[model samples]
Target: MIDLFKFFGKEESKSKDIAKERLKLVLIHDRANISPKFLDMIKDDIIKVISNYMEIEEAGLDIRLSRIPQEDDTYSTALVANIPIRRVKNMGPNRG
Candidate 1:
């Protein structure tokens, strides 16, 4: 059988892509005058809130700020979150 992982791409190459994304995120944050620590705090808050309703793979979580190009040739910073949810939590009755 063919190696599917290799056919698509390897983990090592994925890491490089991740690194590039991170660099882009940093640049975006800087341009938007946002601090890295502030981003971390926001990420933590998101995880805490979402955890109440879902079982997520925190290790695979990727949160960053990105620039969305506007029609006027400008850009707006946006909060981008790529959270890997393993499953939804079974909250009883009123979703406690």
Candidate 2:
């Protein structure tokens, strides 16, 4: 039997990777002059707006700010969100 954990890297390694990613995000936020509380507020607002239309897996949601390369070789900050939607809400005839 194959060791699935080995095939997909060990849990310890995965945790380390997660830590590295979190650290990177923290640094990016600092450079962008954005606070964690502000980011959390934005995330909460996003969830509220999105939840009005569809069911979402809040636990699996991921949102971050990243730098995107531009045509002029300049980098612009962007808000990236990965929201896992479960299903769309059924809107009745009276619903807009």
Candidate 3:
């Protein structure tokens, strides 16, 4: 008779993989409180409003809604926008 207890190793790697997958999901949600759909809505609105004031390349704007973990619980959500400024026709170099 042969002992069949030394054929395969224990399942240690599988546990780590599962834990990593779960952490990724939780971090994604925590960073963005609102769903992906809602974040899209906000980005659109911000670009629209900003366009009215200046000549903004709407397609090039990047407005992301994220959360920041801090000591106190006052302000958690932060809105970050990346807008590139292009010199308009009239707003050229300063001339006399």
C-alpha local distance difference test of each model: 0.92, 0.92, 0.65
Looking at candidate 2, the ten consecutive residues that score lowest on lDDT are: 5-14
Better of 2 and 3 by TM-score: 2
lDDT tens digits by residue: candidate 3, 1-80: 65455333334566778898777545665665567678788888876775655677666787665556688864466777
lDDT per residue as tens, model 2, 8-92 = 7887798999999889888789889999899999999999999999999999999999878899998777899999999999988
The C-alpha RMSD in Å for every predicted model, in order, reads: 5.7, 4.2, 9.7
TM-score head-to-head 1 vs 3, winner: 1
TM-score per model over all chains: 0.72, 0.74, 0.48
Poorly placed runs, candidate 1 (over 4 Å): 1-23
Output the TM-score of candidate 1: 0.72
Tens digit of lDDT per residue, candidate 1, span 9-37? 78779898999988988789899898999
Clashes of each: 0, 0, 0
Where does candidate 2 clash, by residue pair?
none
Error of 2 at 36 (Å): 0.9
Q: In angstroms, how far off is 23's CA in candidate 3?
A: 7.7
